[model samples]
Target chain A: MKLFFGEIYDDHAILNEEESHHFAKVLRGQEGDVVHVTDGKGKLAKVEINSISKKVVEGSIIELKTDFEKKNYYLHVAIAPTKTMERLEFFLEKATEIGIDEITFLQTFHSERKNIKIERIEKIIQAATKQSLKAYLPKVNDLTKFNDFIKQDFENFTKCIAHCEDDIVKTPLKSILENEPNKILILIGPEGDFSRDEILNAEKENYKGISLGQQRFRTETAALQAVFAIDWELKS
Target chain B: MKLFFGEIYDDHAILNEEESHHFAKVLRGQEGDVVHVTDGKGKLAKVEINSISKKVVEGSIIELKTDFEKKNYYLHVAIAPTKTMERLEFFLEKATEIGIDEITFLQTFHSERKNIKIERIEKIIQAATKQSLKAYLPKVNDLTKFNDFIKQDFENFTKCIAHCEDDIVKTPLKSILENEPNKILILIGPEGDFSRDEILNAEKENYKGISLGQQRFRTETAALQAVFAIDWELKS
Candidate 1:
């Protein structure tokens, strides 16, 4: 069954305009057809389509599942947007499919691209979530400055920064993840890498320095690696 | 200093036409300029430009470095080409940057793409290898039938096949990597996934069944995840 994104309206669910169009026109969904709909908030409903239209698709919920595929840990990654938009978008798409909890576009000292369209990234996340048959939707935060971001408190989370700088004593990600903190926030730098002062600032804030691996990875690859490493560690 | 790909001849090295053009035009490399060159065979050499031309740029080896960044384990990933060529190319480029020993295009029963232009893939690998400043160039093998590929003996290498089939008992890749096989060959299926018969054949050949993760990953994402998983496991 095809999955649709929508909102619950009393006993019925109504898909958004884009998803409605996709259902009615693209998928050729018709009235009386059964489909799965996710509310993007841990709700999966099996509904029978009552009406199919371009603006909205109305369905009556037959069965509902809550907290579907909920993970024990939360992973939040803050990364500098790559110079190319496509790489950043690709990271968003893949990271979503890989089961990230939250993402932030960091405006670091060496960041080439300081701005991002949050709405666009959110859409990508939603699409990936549906494609992966995932119940939870990862949150995409607006672009935040490194300086400001560091000042914010993540009191309950295990914080770490991944950098390529050789001077810093960096622990391998796998080693750090062995402790299995319930919540993890990893900072990934840009193509030029995080400035020395930025790394120091993060360190002063208690963000442990970590290394992904030996090979030099691009900003997007590093971001995905961080997500993958966290997910892998959690699973292991 | 920029790195160029070349062939060492006696006490000198010669750059190919593409590299020669890049040296002479893009980098404006001049005679007597110092540059690094890699033979893509675990050889890195510091050379002085002896002559610059469109066809071939000559360089005299000033210093040589061997086995610059050789890893303890070898990783060969055989995956079916994604229907979209860009996704396959993206996988090749990222896999190269992340480090791999060899790549094979697998012709599986459900493979959407049967034929691939090897030259194009080779170019992507070469560019990524140079971009990542690696001493080794990953070998891209010709497309092989799934049956024929399964028949070939892997000798002492650890062979594993990653599939999304739920009925089969699959071990986590990290758990399998704990045994620490010096060499690994991981087979990733196509978008449609490997047929039941193909999976059974691989299992018969001692290809251990492994799961990348819980999420249903796209072909390209799965390929990269497999590569990342192997690299991470070996590093850990």
Candidate 2:
């Protein structure tokens, strides 16, 4: 059975434009074909196709299964976009596959790229979700100033910033993961790295300084490495 | 400081044409400036620039520092290149950052791309090495037929092949990492995966069946995940 993501309403629903074309042309679904659809908000519905077309695909819900929400542990990373969009997209895709809950773009002092194409990034996320068979679509925040995001009220979460400055300020990410929290947020800087003032601002906002091991990683690699380390720690 | 990779005999020699052009025009090296050069075989030399030009950069070796070799373990991941060249480049960059020793592209039953831009990949690896300040460069093997490469003998190493099929395979990567010997080789299949005959042939060659984890990972992600998991296990 093919699975799709869409809005679910009163027993009947239509797949989104992209999903509709995928089902009608790619999958060749006809009337009475069984398929699964998710609202991307924790709702999974088993449906039978009632209508199929390139423009629209309608289905009747056969059953709805609400998943047991997993532990509330959340992984959010705010990092500057890399020069190559492919690197940033790769970061987003792998982070999603590794179970990240949210992602944000920061316009940092030393950031190489300022503008981010949200549409392109969203498509990448969607493709990753389908590949991973994940129902939860991560919350992709619009590009924002690093200082502004730092000032946001992200209480009840462990806040940390990963940098490579030559300082004694170092703590392993595993330490925080072992605490068992509902939310966790980490910040990864750009290739040139975060400016002094940015670090001070993050520190003022209670973002603890941390390091992702000793090797110097590219912007996207550092972000995904932080994601993987934290996720593994939580499970172990 | 600039960095360059060269052959064994050229260990303490001046930068060559391409490297010198990179150092002079691209990196803008001048007299009395210091730079790092690697033999790509675990030797690094710090050199001071005596002259600079587009054709050659004259530098004398000032100090030679040979760091301790990485753990006895090694990783050789045989995977199919993704459709997009940039995605494949992502694999090259991140795999280097996470410490992979070798990468080989195999023509699988469902491989879409056959030809690869070797020169482009070399550039990416060089950039990754300089960014990570690594002395050892992972060897990138030319794309080869799957069976041809698999037929070779792999002595004194634990060899495993990861497949998506459900089977009675008992070689969990976690255990392999814990009990790893001096060398390790893991072969990840393509997007369409290995055919039944390919799996059977691997079994005949004593290639144990292994699973990366619960999640279904893309080719590049699986490759890097294996690298990180093995590295982490050894470190711990």
Candidate 3:
């Protein structure tokens, strides 16, 4: 069965431009053809095409299922963009496949790329989600100043910052994630790493120091590795 | 100090083209400058430059320390390349950063990519090897037909294949890697995955069936995740 993503519960569904083209031209679905739809918010709907036009594809919902609940934990990763945009995009695609709930791009003192195109990243995330048969799309936040970004508060969360500096309280991400708290966030720095002041500020804000591993991983690699480790610990 | 890669036994050292250009032109290093060099076989050399030219930078090895040895375990990941060359390159970069002994690109039954630019992939491996300050380069093999690729024999090796299928034995990679075997190999299929017949053939070949996790992952993501997971199990 072919799967499509669109709005659900509104009686009529309108496919986005990309999705419209894919369904109409790529898959050549016609009126009355059955298709699966996801709202990208954990709602999966079975729909039959009511009309197929170049600009829009309208469908009628035949069946619906809500998948709002996942296995109990949430994962959030904030990291600097790599100097190369491709690497950052790779991180987004893999992180989504591995089930990260939220991703924030930070502009740290040593950050090489200060800006990112969120639209391009969103397309990648959507494609990855669809490919992985996931109903929920991971949220992508715009780039923010490091200090300002670190100020956001969380509820019942174990926050951690993965840094390279010695003398910081450090443990493997797996060890810290053993208990598998309901919500967790981890910070990964750039190639040059977070500045001393940035680290100090994050520490003051209650971000515990954590290490991904002994190897010095690139910004994006470290973020994905942390995601993998977190999932591994929780599942094991 | 600037670093260069050399051979452990090479008393006479002429820096490679990339390194010589980087040190002499990029960094403006002059004669009498002390620099660090690694044979990339596990020997570190403290050298003083005696000559500098456009083609070669010759340095006198003032002191050398041989510290390179094989890791207690080996990680070899054989994966089918994505249609996009960039994705395979990204996997190579991350795998090198995290450390791997060998990488083989296979042509699976569903593989869209039939050929890979071996030179280009090797360049990425070398760049990553230097960036991560590693003493060994991961051996990269050319694209091989899946059937022929699986025919190779191994001794004292634990072999496994990662595929998305309902009937796969699906043991966790962690459990498969728990004994810390000296040699390990994991195979990851391309996008669209291996056909049912391919998985059965591997089962006949004495390969273990393993699952990375519950969430679906891309070809490259699965490859690197296996690399990280196996290393974590071995090193932990």
Candidate 4:
């Protein structure tokens, strides 16, 4: 069954513009057709299409399913965006498919790209979620300054920073994930990597230095590896 | 220090056309310059540029270092080529970066692509190997049929196949990697997945069914995940 995204209002659900186009034009969905829809908030509903339009598609809920897939842990990865948007988009798509809770673009001292279009990233996230048949939609937060992000209190979250600085004896991410903390916050730097002061500041803020692997990975690859490592550790 | 690929012949080394172009034109390497060269066969040498040309560059070995990173275990992933070449190229590049010993393109029942250009893929592997500064260059074999591949004798090797068959209760890859076999061979099916008979035939041939993760991953994603999983298991 193909999955669509929409919002549930009362007994009806309305798909947005893109979803509407996909349903009405691409899929050739007609009135009275049955479709599966998700609200991106862990709600899945079987609905009968009542109206099909270019802008919006309305449907009446036939059955509602609240028991969608739920993640066992919370994974928040804050990464410095790559110079090219494709790499970051690829990371976002793969991370969504592999199960990530949240993603934040960080503006660090060595970051090449400081600004990111959240709207574009959100679209990729939604598409990946639907493609993977996932109920929970991961949030894409706007770009935040590294200093400001570190200042925010994570409280009980297990914080770690991924850098390539040789001066610091970084713990392997696999070892860190061995403990399997319920909430994980990992910071991945850009191509140039985080500066010494940035690493020190993060360490001061309780972010432990962690290394992804022996080979130096690109920004996007490191981010994806972090997500995969976390997910692997949690499940295993 | 910049890294170049060349064959150390006696007391001298010769760079290939692509490497020569990169050395002479891209980097503007001049004579009498010192550069790090790798033979891609677990050998790294410090060489002095004796001659520079667009077609081929010659260097004399000044010092030799053989202490290259070696994997304790062997990983050979045989996967069906994706419909698009880019995804397969991406997988090759990433697998090289993440440390893979061998890659084979398989022609399965549901495989969208049957033929792959070995030369193009080889270039990607060499570039990724240089980018990661690794001494080991992975081997890319020509495309082979799934049936033929399964029939081959993988003596003393832990052979596994990744298929999305509904009837079979696939073992998680993590569990299979727990034993830490010295040699591993994993086969990843294409987009439409392997035919039921293919899975059964493999099972009959001692190929264990392994699941990468819970989510449905694309061909390239599954390949990369398998490589990453194997590397992680061996390293940890």
lDDT of each: 0.88, 0.79, 0.82, 0.88
Question: What docking grade applies to model 4?
Answer: medium
Q: How well is candidate 1 docked (DockQ)?
A: 0.86
Q: In model 2, which regions exceed 4 Å deviation? A: A17-30, A52-56, A68-72, B7-12, B24-31, B51-56, B68-72, B115-117
For candidate 2, give the lDDT of residue A212.
Answer: 76
* Candidate 3 lDDT by residue in tens digits, B61-142: 8887765544677788889999888788888898888878888989998988888889999988988877777767888888
The docking category that best describes candidate 3 is: medium
Candidate 1 ranges beyond 4 A from true positions: A9-11
lDDT score of residue B165 within candidate 1: 92
**lDDT, model 2:** 0.79
lDDT of 4 by residue, B14-52 (tens): 887788999999888999999889989888888999998
TM of each candidate vs. truth: 0.95, 0.88, 0.91, 0.95
Instruction: Tell me the interface RMSD of model 1, in angstroms.
Output: 1.0
Individual DockQ of the candidates?
0.86, 0.47, 0.63, 0.67
Worst 10 residues of 1 chain A by lDDT: A227-236
**Across residues A63-174, which tens digit of lDDT does each residue of candidate 3 receive?**
8778843646788888888998977887888888878899888999998787899899888898888877777889889999999988988768898899988876777776
DockQ head-to-head 1 vs 3, winner: 1
Runs of candidate 3 exceeding 4 Å displacement: A10-12, A16-18, A25-28, A53-56, B10-12, B17-28, B53-55, B62-65, B68-70
**Evaluated with DockQ, which candidate comes out highest?**
1
What lDDT is reached at residue B89 by model 4?
85
